[model samples]
Target: MIRLGGGPLERIVAVGAHCDDLAIGAGGTLLTACRARPGLRVDALVLSGGGGEREQEERAALAAFCPDAELRLTVLKLPDGRVPAYWEEAKTAVEELRGRTEPDLVLAPRTEDAHQDHRCLARLMPSAFRDHLLLGYEIVKWDGDLGRPTAYQPLSPGIAEEKVRLLQEHYPSQRHRPWYDREAFLGLARIRGIECHARYAEAFHVTKLTLNLGD
Candidate 1:
């Protein structure tokens, strides 16, 4: 298990292929991190969805979720479902972000995810943030491809509800999806919570982890 002492986190970067992916995957963890550090700066870097009305929706959604955070939200112009084709460009973008901010932690999508874009991003994350602590979050889709997750970040029931509420409120385009509902949110949380022995929690898969067992 990775344990952190009582000091605050100065910077955090959340990377995702789409606008709502970060929120859906790691929204609770983000909320918990922000609450732990009042002045913490959290950046949401979306590889796409920066054009047209999607940009506006993402901006509003981030503002609501991270009111106090110094937001550095960017939606790359790269085409959706084609991130793997632009592998070099995506690496450059992530490297540029790494150059700008040396975050204490980096949150990214898990490598085992069924989505091609998510898996691509997960594959690229280690190259960009080699020295930083990486947390890989999950998103439930129709494929039912959720795998064994080793990390758990517990969330309050209220925060869990707020996550779903915010996702629904921010992305009007996603409301039509049949899987996007309260049960999906709570059911996933409930399952993860059971793993962590908490009321609610989010699970993550870490490809590599170092334990400082010394006291």
Candidate 2:
């Protein structure tokens, strides 16, 4: 198990390929962090949907979720479902974001995710935030790509239910999808919770981590 140094984490960056990925994946962890450390600065970056109603919805949702933290939401203009084609551009965007904000913690998608966009973004995250703590989040899809996760953050049942409710309320566009129901959210969290011996939980994969086994 990877251990972290005990200290205050002030700056946090959550990067995702889509709008709701961060909230669905690591929202509880983010909320726990912010609540534990007041005045924490949390920035979210989405590589696409910079314009139109999607951007507006995301902004409102983030504001509601992270009211106490500073939010810097950047939705790039890159076309959706085509991020892999524009690998260089995606990398450049992530690098630029990294240059702007040096966060203490960075949450992103797991490379083993099913979606190509999520996987591509996961591969690009390491290039920018090499020194910070990185948590790779999982997204459930038809591919069933969820693998064995080494790290888990338990979420309260209320928070897990709230996450699904908020996603449904905020992102109306994605509601029509077959997998966008509360059952899917709770099912995934329940499975992860079983892995971690919690009521509800979110799982992640870590590439490199330092352990501090001190008293």
Model 2's TM-score against the true structure = 0.93
| Candidate-wise lDDT, in order | 0.85, 0.84
Runs of candidate 1 with Cα error greater than 4 angstroms are 1-7
For candidate 2, write residues 3-122 as lDDT tens digits: 345356889888889888888888767766766777788878898887888888888877766758887788887888888998999999888889888888889999888798999999
lDDT of 1 at 190: 87
TM-score of each: 0.94, 0.93
Off by over 4 Å in 2: 1-6
Range of the 10 consecutive residues with the lowest summed lDDT in candidate 1: 1-10
RMSD in angstroms, all models?
A: 1.7, 1.8
Residue pairs of candidate 1 with colliding backbone atoms: none
Report the number of the highest-lDDT candidate.
1
